[model samples]
Each structure stands twice: as C-alpha cells, then as structure tokens.
Target: MDFFKFLYRSRSAFDYADDNPFGISTLLNAIIKRLQQRRKLTLLLAACLCLAAPCYAHAHIFSPLLEAILPRSSSEKPQASTAATDTVTSDTKITLPTDLSNPSTTTAPAVELELTKQPRPPLSEPSLYALLDAEFAANRGNTRRALVLYKQQSFKEDATAVFERALGFSLNNEDVHESLDFAKSWLDQNPDHVPAWFYVAHLALKAHDYTLAGETLNRILRYDPRADLSEILIGIYPENDDDQRELLAALQPIDSQQNASLSVLKAGLLNQFNDPQNALIHINRALLTQPDYVPFITLKADILRKIESTETVLSYVNQARLRNPDSKNLYLYEIRYLLDLKQSQQAWELLLKAQNRFNDDNEITLLAALVSLDVEQYRTADQLLNILVKSPAYLDQAYYYLGISAERQQRFEQAKYYLNAVVREDLVLAAREKVVSFELLNDNIEGAINTLQLLRQQYPVFAPDSYVMQADILWQHNEAEKALQLLTRVSRKYPDNELILFARAQLLDDSKDYLIKRTLLNHLQALDPSNLSYQLSYAQLLLANNRSSEQGLELAKNLIQIRYDDPRYDNELQLQALNLLASNALATENYAQVINYLQTPYDVLPTLRSGELLLRAYQGLGADEKVEALLADLQQRFSFGQRNVNDRVQLY
Candidate 1:
C-alpha cells in the first residue's frame, strides 16, 4: 500500500522540471489511464452479462485488472466487490492463463457448463469478491494487495474501500506509493480526512515534489486552514518567491490551530536542504507552541546529533523517551547515542529493554547488531545481521559488516565472499578503499597499492586518504624524498584539510633539514591553533635549535597543561622540558634548583642511556656516597661477572 501511495502522492517530475518535467509523468499517467479503462470495461461487461441472462443465476464478472492486482487466489473468481474483503491468504493459488477466451483450458471449471450439463458441486467456485474476503480474513499481513486495489480503482466513487485497504497496508510499508496517491485523493475528496493528507504531504516532500504537494496541502488548509505548509514549501521550493507569500498568507488566517507535529516535520525537511540553522529556528518555534511535544524534542535532538553534539543529543533523546516511553524510534535512537558516547555497557542494557518492548522487531535487531559490531562481539553480531540481510532496508550494510566480522575471525575466504555481495556503488567503493589496509596487513604491498589505485579512480574527489597511507608506507620503506614529495602534493591539493596539512608538517620535521623545519612546524601550528602534537613538537624543535630560553620552556608548559590526558602524551617531551630547565639552573649554579630537579627521578627503563644519565646527575651534585651506592645497585642490576667485594667502584 505504501508503494502505491508513494507513487500517486509522489509529485510528478514536472514539479522538478528546471525547464521540463522530471520525466516520470508519462509512465505514471499511462498506468492510471490503463487502470481506468479496464475498470470501465469491467462494469460494462458485468452489467451486460447480468441483464442478458436474467433467468440464469448470476455471478459478477469482476474487473480482470482489479482481480489480477489483488493477491492471487485459487479459491475465488477474481472479481471487484466489497462483499469479500478478507485478508489475502497464502493458500490462494493463481496461474495466469495464456488464453482468457478458452475457459476449458484453465483449472477453473465453467460455471454455466457445470450448472446446466452436469450435477453441480455443493458450492459454486467462490467469486473474486469471496477470494478477496478470504484474503482479508486470513490476515496474512499482506499490505501490497490493498495498495494494488486502490491503484486499480481510484477513478470510481467506491474508491473509499480501496483507500481503507491501502491505509492498512501503509502501516507496514512506508515506501508504498499507491497508499500515498490514494491518501491524497482521499483527502481531496473528503477534506475532513486529516491523516490522509498528512501522510500524502510527507510522501510528496520525500519524493522532492513541491508543486502538486502544495496543491494537496492547500486542500488540507481549506479544511483546517491552520495547517502550516509555509516552512515545508519554503524548504522544498527555495527558488519560488510567490510560494513564500502564499504559504505565509495561508498560515496567517488560522495560526492559532497549527499542530506541533506537522511543524517539526516541516523543520526536519528544511534541515535536509542545508538549512539547519533555520531548521533549528522552526523546531524551536514549534516548541514554543507546544512545550511538551515529544516529536519536536526528538527532531531537535536529531538536528543536534548531526552537528556532533553527542552529549546534547543524549540529553534531548532521554527527555523525549521519558515523555513518551512507548516511542520505538526514540529508544532505538538512544541506543545509538549511548554507543557514540562510548557507554557500551549502558547501550547493551538499553538494547535488551528495547527488544522486550518491540517484541524483537527486525529494526531493533539490526540496531543491536550494529552496537554489537561496534563493541567487537563479532559472532553475536553475525547471527543478528544475517537475519536482517534478508530485508532490502539493511541488506547491503549487513553484507559489509558480515565481511568485517569474518575478517576479524580470520575467515578470510568467508570475509571476501561476504564483501563481494555488496553491489551498491558507494558500498563497493568503501570496501575497495578498505582493501589496501587489509592487504598491507597481510604483507601484500602490490595488492594493497593496486586496490588503492582502483579505489582512487572511483572516488577521485574523496579527499585522498589513500595518498596519506601510501606516503606513510613510503616513509617507512626509507624512500624519504619521494614520501615528502607525495605529501607535499597532497597538501597543495587540499590545503584546507587539516589531516593533510598535519601529515605534511610531520614529514618535513622528520626530514632533519633544519633550514625550514621550524618554518614548516610554525605554519602547521598556525593552521591548527589547538593541535597539541604540533604545539609540543614545535617546542621540542625550538629547544633542539638552541632556542630553549626564547620560547621552548613556556610552550612545553602550556602544551602539558592544555592536554593533561591527551592520547599523544610522550615522556620524552616531559623529560626534555625538565632537562632544559635543570641545565639552565646548573648554568647559573643554583644548587637548590639543581638538587630539586635531581630529586624528581628521570624515567629510567630498559635503556643504558637513562642509567648513564642518572649516574652523571648524581656525580654532578657531588653526592659521592649516594653515587657509590647507586653504581653498586646498577652493577648488580647489569652485572658482567662475580668479583671480590670491595668498597671501591670504577666509572670508565
């Protein structure tokens, strides 16, 4: 039903025609006209045959098109009648006949022939209406039939029945165009039908058609007059000056009666068109009208989520769930929010609660699979995603992640098989981009580069991540100048991108060419004012260039204070700062400062240089007793051989 609804309520390509229509009107109009013609013929044939055989018991000859469009059934003669609107049954069998005129060729026995020529069965074959009734009665959860029926008979006044069927179908199939068309037509014919137009407008906007969508919305306003279509039209029709005025005029007449849910939806649509700031404005405005609107809160949360405000998003989504605990979408969204915040334990706990709530829905299952994958529970993630892959909504994603899980488990052959299932261009390109990383890990340099080459061709404008990877590999292989040249070109091509700029600066610093080492590091620091690594590196470089007093000590102190828990914390940087400060104190012969610095132990480890540094520091302080004692301990720690015990020690 959602499929057909999607089709009808969907704006014709004419709405998007820059100079010409979107070019889909011909196909759609053709389907509509064909259905109309078939319907009229069905009526004429049924009426004529009934009148001609007045003496004979009559059965309706249903519209073949209508019957064909319904769920195929063997138990019923395909016919259009409201008498048998049962849920479609799986047992309903249908075999399309090559010859309609030759009735004997089909398994369906001739009704007249059986009535007059032989003993009649206890019951005549069920009419198409009866079959449809059985289908509706079976309640097999077939939503497609309702959508097809509406699309088949939309021209008739009796379309209300078809529309009802379509509405039922729409609950299960959100993408059904038939339900959208019927819903739109239903609203136009019955102005009081609010939900019909609501869904129709939603489908229209999603399909990117604003013209007829505006017309359908105008019909809604004619009844309620307070329905705000302005924001939606403004978002959908940015270039049209008149639409804004018309939308504004419509809103002014009945502004007090506007619904909060519709307004938030409009704002969300605006956000889709790169108007997030304005989107936030509209959503906030809706909140002013209905302060406790859960949908509006969720919409705002979604907006914040897109901007990477994980904490804010979690806060708002939690508020929404508190207000409306039954909202499946909010629960599912919160699970993702927990994952982004790295609260994986909390995420798993919420996932269990959601499963119990939704009765193990496929959408929730897929969401759980994603969270499991994130936390490295590959086997459990595989089991959940395998079931979801059967659905088209998540099929491609399932294949990609299944490939990842397989690779993690060292099932390389299985991983490749799963990866090969992703046929979507974007997914395939992303998979190809990953190929180099995996190949290089497996020690296949040529395979890695070849994979990267193919990826670069497909994603020529994808910001050249492969170039950085390749340059790093080259640097490790000792092709220093070539590595530098590659990074330089990449930086030149994408100057505004911080990653390339940072990489280029690091490469130059590593080149050991002092002439421009400070200059390059300075440029990188300026480009990214808050880059802790570059700030610290610049300090180290300054000290190495004999500029410790000029700025090195102050810069190093600032770097450590700013990034107390930064991931790039290096003991060497801290030691350099301390060593420089201590050397300055000794230069002035400040014995107290020297003693204070020496008291803070050097970070000695599995290194002879650190031991030697410790030995030198003790001797400089003239603490002979402490020095002799430390050297004895060091000799025992790294002893060459056993010797006679003596109070004397030698330093060569």
Candidate 2:
C-alpha cells in the first residue's frame, strides 16, 4: 500500500486500486512477500520507481521514500525533528519519490549543495584547432593575426611548443622586440631552458643591448662552460673604444681561471681591441693552468711579435717547441721566423726536421718544398711539390712551385704545363710571366705574344708588366719599330709606371740614344732615389756612353763594395756594378787594378760575366799561362758543346 501511494504521489494523485482493485491487491501481496523475504528489497523498489519516472525534480523525496519503505527497528529511537535533510553534489540532480501513506506528512529539508573553485584542465582538441589556425595565419604572412592567436593560445595553456613557435615567427619577421618579449616569457616559465636564454641573448645582441646580452651569455656559461662564445661575439660590433671597453668589462667577469677557453676568448677579444698587453695577461693566466697548450703558446708568440719583441717571440716559440717537440705548428712558426730573419738555411733545416716528423702533413710538406726552393734545392723541392700537386688545399701553390722548379732546371715544356695550371691570383701573374719566358725560350714567338695578351686580359693589375714583357720579346726578335711603338703606347697609358719607363729607356739605349736614355734614367732615379738597381743601371749607362767615366767608375766602385751577403742586395745588380768597374778600369788601362778587381776565384764567383771579365783582365796582363789554364778549366766545366772562351768573351 505504501509503495502504491509513493508511486501515486510521484506521478499524480490517482489511485490504482480504484481502476483495478484486484490487480492492486495482487501487487501489494507480491511487494509484502518480497519485503518479508529480504530487507534490501526497499532499494530495488526505490530504483524501479526512479527508472519509471526518469525525470525526478528533487533529491529530498528520497528521505520520505526511504522512511516509508524501510521498517524501523523496535529499539531504534525517533529523533525529535520531523524533517530529514540530505545533501548531494554531482553533475546531475536526481529527485526521489515522496511518501503519501502517512497522513502527517514527512517534510524533507532542502538539499544544500556547495561549490568550490577547480583548476582549469589542459587545452583539448578545440584548442589544437585554434593553434592550427594560428599556424595558417603565420604561414600566410599574417603575423599580426597570428601573434594575436598565438598569444591567446600560449596564455591559455602556456605550452613550450607554442612559446617556441611564437618566438621563432617573431624573429623571422624581424620583430626583435616582440621576440624578446616572447623569450622573456619563455624564460620566466622555464628558467633553465638554455636555448631560450640563447635566443634572448641573440635578440639582445641584435638590439645592441650588451648588458642584457652579456648577462644572458653568462647565464648560458653557467649552464654549459664549453659553449663557444665566438658565435655570440661575432655579432657584437662595438662602436668605439669606450664601447669595446664596456664589452670587455662584461666578458671579463665571466672568464674564470678554471675555464681556459673563456680566458682565451677574452684574450682574443682584448687583442682585437688593440689591448695586447692586457691580452697577454689573460693568455699568461691561461698558460699558467695549461703551460703546454699549443694555441696559447702560438697566441703568446703572436702577441710578442706585435710588440716588436722579435727575440722574445723566438724564445716563446722555442719554449713551446721544448714543451711540445712534435708540434708541427711550432716548427712551422719557428721556420717562418727564421725565414723572416733571412736565415734560409736555418729555416730549411727546421723544415727538414718537421718533414721527418710530419711526413704525411701536406702543409708541412708544402712549407718544406718552399724552403727547399728558397735554398735552391730544386730537385728536393720538385719531389715535395709533385706530392702536393694533387692536394686541393695546396694545388695552386704546388703547381706554382713546380713551374718555378722546372724553370730553374731549364725544362721549358714542363714549366709551361705546371705554370698554366696555377690559378691563385697572387701567383697567377708570376706563373704567367714564367710561361711567357718559357714560350720565348722555346722560340714560340706567337705563343709568347698570345700569352702576354691573355695575361693582360685576365689580370689588368699586371698589364703594365705584360706590356713590358711583350716589348722585350719584340726587341729580342729584331722588331725594333714594333717594340718602340708598343713601349710608347704602354708608357702613355701608365705614365707614372717606372717599369714601362725603364723599358722605353732600354729600347732607346739599344738605339744608342744616350740623351733620351739619360733623361729616362734620371726620371727613374727621381721616382725612387733609394733604388740601388736604378742607380747602378744609370751608372752603367753613363759608363757605356763615356759621358762621365770617372764619376761612373766611382759609383760602380761604391756599389761593388756593398755587401752581397745581405739577401736584399741584388746579386745581379752587384755583378753588373763589378763588370762596369772592370770595364771602366780596362778603358783607363789600369791592367793590374783590373786583374786585382776580377781576381775573385772562379769557384767563389756566381756569374759567367765575372769569369769573362777575369779572362779579359788576364789578357790585359799578358798572362798567357793563366789565360790558357782558365780557358782549359772553362771548357771542361761547360762541357756540353761548349764554345771557346775567346768566342764567349771579347778578349782585349
């Protein structure tokens, strides 16, 4: 009966007993039997009632419904209050059936639900679509709209991916201030992100905010001590000394004694700013920790050289060599220093030692070859250069040296082949000059002229030299008129060029135009008054013309007295001066004096001209036995179809 009444009140006020009295009685009997069998039947009945309605309005109905369905125990005490209260919190509210059996109505207290704040969940699929939209805008060059959407998404979720994308887009668009803001936001969220710190530093550097950039770099170094500062420092172009000092000040604090790389970097920065003294201090500090460090040793030597402390530079290099005897760089440095000191023999010896140690090193081999060439060991240089010709790094230099070695050996074809292969701008002119000479030596006059044309077309900087070479070739071939025309054309084009002027003068001298020759020589002397070669040439021309033989003889004597041991003293010029002196002496009939001047032994003498002059002096002295002995020796020394000494020299 109570269940029927409960259902009756849940739907409407209708009595099922009135409609079907027998059915109501049967249903009541079944419910009573089930309740008697099991006390949990009330929950089943309440669930059925809830299912049948499916739209309960209030949960308070459950209080009355349970009160009527559940049988109270005999010992259970009743509360004084007539109302029952139940509170529930869930996504959906469910109302229970109210009791209608009791005439005194059961009143259920209203359900009181409390709400509290909950954290927001992560962005879901819809947010991803929004991000895709942002990407589309960014890709379509709508940066303003894209930044708006990106900021919305980033602030909504603060994802690392979103932050990175926004930052990169801003930087790619050259919105440095926007990129900086994004970097700051990223760092704020992820303080330990090294890449974010680097981005900030880069942006700061672009903005010329050295302080922020340096601070950011310092943060990076704190995270990774081995990070290369060179990449960051490359963009930092300080405006003046004060700016440079400011940058140095910022870097110095980060350079600790334990970090040798940072110290070296700081030293390099200081050196770049022309503060080598301070750079030396930092380098020494680094060396104190790593005394045998090769780069530091090299840097120290370079700093010493910059200060003109040549001896100290050598000593530093030697110290480094002692520490690292097998270091090829130190050996090369010492060799270069020796070469700079005009110690070719010493340089060659050092290079030989280096080659023994680093035989497979192409740079070492190349240096050895160059030093060998300097010492006139053409065969050894040829072997080394042949090995280097296939190397990409040394190909041009190797070909150049090979050409020079072949030229030295008088192998004209081989010289032309190697010289043609050279392409480096610094060596190209020299190689072309050699090629021209080889062509002329081979009697290929057309080929020689063609090469000069090509050389002038390819390298205009050497056009004057090419013009002079072409003129010389024409003059050699007895095309005196063409030679003079070419010389005049080149001289007019390069009016101030001493080489062209000298070429024209030589042509005039060949024509015995002594006045014009003297004027040209005077102009050359005025152009470079200290050039000993020009002075000697002028003196020889004066002697040749017999204009001032005494004055020319004194000048020639003074020039011959110049020590030829110095490499700067041109051997060819000295020999010319000696010949001029001997010729002037012979003109004056100073026979004994001429013999004394030309009496330098044939073995010690460098030029055939000296021997020829000596033979003339012997003829002047009427020393028949001495002349016969010299002639026999010259014939034996120059044995390959050699001409007689009388034919070679003008025997007075």
Candidate 3:
C-alpha cells in the first residue's frame, strides 16, 4: 500500500527513493505506475520485465487500449513533466537493496489504500466503468457512443457482460450483422454459454447463413442436449420449395443426433418437400427412440400416405391408434384419410367416436362439423359450429364455416352475416370472398364491388387482390369499359402491383388496346421476369401484332428453350407456352408448324383448343386419313369419359 504513492515519481526517484524499498512489490508498483501514467500498455509489461532488475520495458501495439481504460478526468491527464517514453530509465548498472523495512517506507501514503473484503469481479475498475458508461450511453439512445465504449471494454478483459450488452443494443437497432459479431465475441470469451450460442444461431438463421446457423445450433445442443429448440425452429420460414430445401439442409446435422424431436422435425420438412421416401427414413429413425410418440407416428403415416393408397395409410393409422388410443392426432389422421377415400359416413362416425373419447376436444368437433357439411347434413353442421363459435380460439374458423353452411342451404343473407363476422387475418379474406360470391350470384354487381372495397380498407395487404376481383366482376357483368377504368385508377396508386397490371393487360388485349403493352407489360416483365403469367401475357401481346410477329415468336421460343429443359418448371406453364406458339403458327397459316407445336399437347392431354388446332392442321394439309383417325380417337375419348376437355380456354 505504501508503494502506490511512488507511482507519480520521476525515473531518478523510482531508481533511488526505493533503494531501501519494502521489496519487489514496491519496486514493481513504481514501474507500473510510470508506464500507466504515460498511457502506454506495453506488451512486455514492466511488472514482468522488472522482476530481474529496476527497469522499464518496451511499449507498442496497446497504446489505444490503455488510453481507453484510463479514467476520463482532468486530474488523471498525463503529466507534461516526463517526456522519456523509454523502456529502461537509465543506462547505469544498478543493484537492488536488500532492506525490506524502513521508517520512510512506512510513512503515510499520498493516496489511502482502503482494501475492503469485496469479492473480486471479472473486470478491473477501468474496464468495468467502460461497461457502465456503455450501458448509460445505450439507455440514452446514443448507440454509436455505446458501441465504442463496449468495444473498448472488451479490449481490456474477457468482459462477457459487455459483449452481451453490445449484442442487445445491436439487436434492438435491428443491426442483425453487428449483433452476430458481438455474439461471436461473447462466445469467444465464454464458449460454454448456451444463451450466447443461441444468439449466434438466431442471427445466423436470420441472415440465411444456414451453414453458420447449423454449426452454432450444433454447439448449443452439445452444451445442453435437452435445450428447447422450438423458438429457433419457428424462426425458420421457408417461402418456396428451394427455400425449404436449403432449410432442410441446414437442419441435417442437428437432426442427425439421436433426438426424437429433431428427427421428427427433419422428417416433417422432408415430407413437405414431397420426398416421401427420404421422409420415411427420418421418421423411422425418430420412431426408434420413441416408438409410440404420437406425433412421430402421425408423421410416418402421412409420409406413407403420399406413396401408399388411402386405405393402406388409414390401416397403419388405425394400428397406431390402437396402441395410443388417447392420442388426438391418430384420430385426426384416420378421419382425414377416410375423407380422402370419400367415405363420408365412416368419417362422420369416426369423428363422433373421437368427440366422445376426447369430450372437450375442439378439433374433433370442428372436423365433425366439416364432415357433416360435406354430406349435406346442414342442420348437424350448424349445431357443431354454434358450439365452436363460443370459443375465443375457434371463433373466426367457426364463423367462416358457418357462413359456408348457410350458403349451401341458399340462405345468402344469413351466410353474409356469419362470414362478415370472421376477424382472423387468415380466414377473413375467404369469408369476405364468399359473401361477394353471394352478391354476384344475384346479379348484384354494385354490392359485390362494395364488399371488395370494404375488404381492401379492412386489410390493406389484400388491396391488390381485391381490386383485381372487382375488375373481374365488372368485366363479367358486361362493364368491360368500367373494369378497364377501375384497374387503370388502381394501377396509378399501386404501380408495382403485378395482379392489377395483369388484369389491366387482359382487359387491354381483349379490347384491342395493345398500345399500353410497351410501357405496362415491359415494366411488369422487368419487375418479375420469372413470373410465367407475365411472360405468357407479354408473348400473347406481341403475337397479336399481325399474328406472325417475330418478337412474339422469339420470346415464346426462348421461354420454351429456357424452361422446358428444367425438370422443376411448372408443367402447366410449359404447356401454355406451347399453346401460344401453336396459336401463332395457326395465325400464320403454317399448318405444318401448328401440328409440330400441338402434337405433344394433344398426345399428352389436349384441351379443346389444342385438339381443335391439331385437327385443323391435319385438315389443312389434306391428310384425310389422319384427320379421320383423329376424329375417331377424340370421339372414343369422349365416349369412354377418359378425358374431360376444359370448355373455358385461354385466348393465347
């Protein structure tokens, strides 16, 4: 404690004043204070270097770190009296005195050392204060200042709390990438911290850096094998099949463990990807650990349902139900399979049994009501729905289905009242659409439009779809000009809305208004070039240019060349493109070209238009035998009811 005052000494005082020093403790304190006063944190710290002799050490690389840790105050400022930032205070050889006690050394110190019995904390004073100031700055909403302090605090010690605080602030600011960096820093100091690992996993998942996410989640599982992963799993939302595949790959290492929950999750994802065989492999892996796990069994049954017949899957579900009679999922699975087989009576009976066994089960009740409606048992369906409508959780679904029940009974007014009462975001659109359909049935065009307008106001996210529906209803009611005008006005408000643009394009092409194609269709195509509908519409517009338009032909040909070879391309869109090409050929009186395009469509599955085009091409080529043979095959298909040609054809 007495040695602390010598920390303010010059090099002469440090080398001579402690000649009859208390020991090494007093000598090292002088050297440490000398270096610290100069605001230099030397790599060869004086405390370590001064053990052999009275000396200072080299200083480099840690200057900024020491400056940050030094207390911020005027009194603590570097003294201008000392300019020598040297490692050794003197070149003269010096010897350490052996005396451990002296009257001068025992004198009252300039700074009192009040040593209380407080437990040692993780960080020293300066580093700890840096964290405190960092938090203060954060609470004051000065994020940049707080981050600087947090980073400074981290430099002095393995201050895990400071890294955690920085991470919290970064996340609060929605700076996901920064939060992830802080999270990694936190784990670097304390690798075993589960919460820090979870933070890393969450941020990695958000960035779609699935490889990092998988690695972090694997570390978390190693820390706590039974850790709850539901929150992390829920954050993953795959928007399409490709996204789902990526997410599945990310979860592979996690599910590879012998954990039933993880295995079931992977199996469920594989099933959704429609890889039923792979799904079966993972589900069976899960069942090995928890053979009678109801959800796992249910998933296995579902995966089999994709490959096996409805009856076979139902039998497997029935066997599982016998083993786990109390499981609600088994009952639901059996009922679904029964319904798929069109055994409505058996489904209703099974639902009744389920309802009795699980008397308070709302799911069984809902399923029963739906089955009743399917069988036209309207009174029974209404009774079940009346009960569901009382539950807060099921209120929206109840109202939506009750509306359908009423509509089926031709009680349109009551149905509208019920449907309009649905408030759930998921169900509201369908409910209102059903009400609009009722109005349209009675030639009530204005009422239908009003319903759609109200829907748009109630749910702005659905505004584009509502506007498209309104235009469709108007055009259907012989108000094509009004439909065109309504879409045009809406397009100005939502210029990027493809649905509105598509509807407007349809109206324009129908009314021979090809002039807007250059601006409207070009913008629409550029906005989402991958949208097959836009490509088809744009192709149709070009082909409408005197029927043999080269641009239209090239686009249609390019569409086929690019997408036709891709195994994942939508078959319907490919067929539609082929139809557009055949239509162009027919327009150009190139009968042979028409046959070339329509031949595949006719052989695979012909819509009326494709069949007609092929027939016309045969007749034009004067192939009487081929034309007669085609007629005989078409009549046979219609007679045997092998194919049902769609009546409403696309103009393209």
Candidate 4:
C-alpha cells in the first residue's frame, strides 16, 4: 500500500472520528492517485508543503506517523526520538526534533526544514574518487571540467589540496587571477609553505607591491635561511632613484650578515648613484665576513678606485689576490690597479702571471697584450695579440693592438694587414689612419695616398681628416700647389673645418705667403676667438713677417706669462708661446733675454726650431763650451738628418 493508505488505516484505528475530521488521509490518497497521473504536479505540491512547514514540525509529525505505518522487523532496532541529530549521507546530516508536547519545542505549524543548522558529514571515499577523476581530467587537458571538479571538491574535503590543484590547473591554463585567488586560499591554510610563498612573492613583485613582496621574502628567509634572493631583488630595477632608494631601504632590515650577496648588491646600487663613500662601507662589511669572496673584493676595489684611493685600491686588490689566488678576475683587478697607478712594469708582470695561470683566457691575454704595448714590450704584445686574434671575443681589439705592435716594431706590412682586418666600426677609422701613417713611414707615398682615398670613400665621416692627411702627403712629396688646392677644396666643402683651415695656413706659411696665411689664421680665430693656439699662430706669423715684431713679441710674452701664472693653462700653449718669444728674441739679437726665456729647461722648448734658436742665442752670447754642449745634446736628442751643424742650427 502507498503511504497515504497506510496512514489512513492507522488514523482510523487510533482516533478515526474527530482527529481525522479534515480527512488528511483522503487528501493524501487523492494526491498519490494524482501523482500517478501527473508526477510533476505532485512534486510541485510536495515541495510547497515541505517549504511551508517548520523543520521540528515535520519531524514531530512524521516520526510517529512513520512508526505507526511502517512495521519494524524483529531484528531492526528503533532510533530514540530524543536524539538531536544523525548522519544521512556524505553530503548531509539531519537533526531530530525535541519532545513534541513541550511548548518550547513547538515550531511553526507548517513543515520548514532547517538544513543549515545540521553539521555536514565528512566526504566519503566516493568524493575522493571524484577528486581522482578531476586529476585525470586535468591530466587529459580538460582544464574547464577539472577546475569545476576541483572547486566542488574544495567544498567537500581537504580544501587546501583542492585549492592547490585548482591553482596548479589555473596556472597551467594561464588564468592568473584565478590562480592567484586559489593560491591565496591555499596559503591561508598553510602559511608556512615556502613554495607557495615564493609564488606569492613573485606575483607581488610583478604587481609592484614591493612591501608585500619583501614581507613574503622575509617569511621565506625565516623558514629557510639559505635562500638566495639576491638575483630576484637585483632584477627589480626601480623606475627612479627615489624608488631604488626605497627598495634598498626596504631590504635594509634584513640581516646583511646572513646574506652577504645582498650587501654587495646594495653596494653596487650605491656606487651607481655616486655615493662611493657609503658604498665602500657596505662592501667592506661584506668583505670582512666573506674575505675569500672574489666578487665582494672586486666591488670593494672598484669603490675605492671611484673614490680615488689608489694606494688603498692596490692594497685591497693584493689582499684579495692572497685570499683568492686562483681567481683570474682578482689578477685582472690587480693589473688594472697597477696600470691606473702608471706602474706599467708591475702591471705587465701581473698580466704575465695571470696569463700563465689562465693560459686559455682571452680577457687575460688581451690585457697582457695591451699592457705590453703600454710598456713598449712589442714582442710580448705581438705574441699575446696573435693568440687573441683567434678568439672572436677579442678579435677586433686584438687586431687593432697587433697593428700598433707591428707598427712599433717597424713591421709596416704586417701592421697594415692586421689593421685592415679590424672590422669593428669604432676601430675602422683609427685603423685606417694608422694604415696611412704606416704607409707613409714605409716610404710608400703612393700607398699612403691610395689608403687615405679609400678611407675617405669608405668612411665618409672621416673624410675631412683624410683630406688633411692627403694634403700633408702631397706637401711631403713637394707637390705644394696640389696640396694647397686640395686644402682649399675641402675647406670650401667644410668651411668650419679647423683641420683643413689649419693645413691651408701651414702650407701658406711654408711658402712665406704671410698675407694669405694671416687671412686664413684670422678666419680661424674669428670662428673660435678664444682659441689660444690660433692666437699663438697669428702672433708667430706677425713675428715671421716682421710687420709687427714688437707687438708680436709683447703678445707672445703675455701668453707665456698667462700659462706660467695659471697652472691649468694648456702646456702646448705655453710651449708655443715660449718658442715664439725665443725666436723673436734671437732675431732681435737680444741674447740675454733669449737666455732668460729659453734657460728654463730644455724640456720647455716647444719644437726643434726653439732648440736651434736657444743654441744660436748661446753662440751669440759667445759661450763656446755651452754651445758645444748644447749642440752635442741637440744632436743626440734629435734626428737632424744629414745637414751640417750650421744648417741644422738655423731657425727657419
């Protein structure tokens, strides 16, 4: 029988007359019969009745009714009505009502189930099996279904694990916001998880939440003291100096003693801001703990160098070498220190030691070659450069230095070959200039001209310099008119070109055409009125033409006095002025003044012309012994070709 028929029979047996006045059984029977015909309509009425009643009313009303209609087997045990609650399934538990006769126990007359008050049951093994399905789906690359399953499982059991899986899947699908939310929930469950913290910190950094990132990093460090966060922090370059300072300040509370790498990074940042003094303090602190750490030592040395404590730099680098004897970089640092101190020989020795230790290292080889070049050890430089040229890392620089080494050794052809091999754009013009110079030095005038021409065509940026070089070569070949014409043409093309104008003036001065020379010099001076070199040239021309000898002498004397009074004045200017003064004095037969002017030092003489004039002044003063000594000194110090003593000694 259906529930309604059983209920009606039971009610009839109990109190059939008054309690059943409403005929609940008859109505229930009608509903049941109708449910067979219209099941949807029956479900709708049952849902409405269930919603309309209180939860305790349903229990009080149903318990006795169910007990009366459903006969229990002898083996079946009855549940106590006083029990508060019991589990129904993995997803649900139901609470039983209190004593129905108690007024306080009474609920609303309508059946209203309060499922929210019941404690949920723990997920069963079937839910775990569903989690496995989620894993499989995720593995199968069905991320959408897997996320839904994982989320549903989170509400069931092991929410941390569920959230972690969801996060992993979300990240795999590149759903960053979802992944972040899942990660946050997972971390909330397990805050001490280091890997999770790393993701949080990384994402925080990406989001530019530096404070949060720093806190996360600190938490990670507390858990694992040896975590290397130096690279991560260093990679975060701020937008401005203030932001960088703020970042460094944020990191300062972390113990530098525990992380020396962080200290070194801060020192580097400080050095970049030109705060070498403070930078040194941090670097030294790091070095104290990590004396054998090569990078810290190198940073300390660099900071000291920036502050210009050369002796201290040398001492620090030497100490670093003792601690890290096998460190090639320390050796390089020492070499660089010595070179900066102008102790070239010491630098060369250190470079050789570095080469022996790191025989295959190209950087050491390049340094050795460059230092050898500096100390005039051409053969050693040449050998090192030959090895360096084979390595692409140092090929162009090696070729450039090899050319210089060969040129120093007077191997012009080899120098040209090496120079030509230099293809680095920065080195090309310099290499071409050297090639042209070497060609001229080798007495191949035509070759020099050809090289300069090619250089002009290939590197038009250097065309003006090439033009000047070509003019000089033509002038050396006694082709004065050709040289002058070349200078004129280039000067017109590059009117403001000082080099071309200077070359033109020189040719005119050589031809003794003072008027045109003065005009060109005036134009140059007009272009740069403050140019002392141009002023000196103009004065020299004035003295040469004897047009304004006294005025020229006075101007030259004033220039020399200016150079003497102000040590910052150009040495070349001082030399030129002295040469002019001495020449004018010699011409005027002012032997005493000439002696006073030129007797400062032989080193002070600007050129061979000044030296010759000094000698003539000594001759005019009738000091034969002084003359012979000066003559011998000049002949030994200078290469005066096959000219007689008088011819060599003649100024102009």
- RMSD to true structure for each model, in Å: 19.9, 26.5, 17.0, 22.3
Local accuracy of candidate 3 as per-residue lDDT tens digits, 1-652: 2222343333345456344334433544545555455643332233222321333232422333334334332456533211111121112111111110000122111211111222223544344234434543444455676666665454334344344444544555534555566566556655554555656676776667778888887865665555555545544565777766787898876735554556677889989978899889888987986789887887898799799987788788899898998988888888887887889999998888898798687888998999999888889889988889889999999999999999889899999999999989999988888889999889898899899999999899999999999989989878989999999998999988888988888888623567776578889989987787787778888777757677777777777765656764777777778888887787778999989888877888867667767777777787878776776676676542123322211111
TM-score of each: 0.39, 0.47, 0.58, 0.52
lDDT of candidate model 2 versus the reference: 0.67
- For model 3 the TM-score comes to 0.58
TM-score between model 4 and native = 0.52
Candidate 3: residue pairs that collide: none
Candidate with best lDDT: 3
Worst 10 residues of 3 by lDDT: 94-103
Candidate 4 collision pairs: 53-110, 53-111, 53-112, 54-110, 54-111, 54-112, 55-112
Query: Mind giving the per-residue lDDT tens digits that candidate 2 earns over 130-225?
Result: 454454355445566666565545433225445555554455553455556656665764565454565677667656666887788777666555
Candidate 2 ranges with C-alpha deviation above 4 Å: 1-127, 134-158, 165-195, 217-243, 252-258, 272-277, 287-293, 304-312, 318-331, 390-396, 409-414, 420-429, 438-447, 453-652
Give lDDT per model, in order.
0.56, 0.67, 0.68, 0.66
Leading candidate by TM-score: 3
Clashes of 1: 29
Q: Which residue window of length 10 is worst by lDDT in model 4?
A: 94-103
User: Distance from true position, residue 52, model 1, in Å?
Assistant: 53
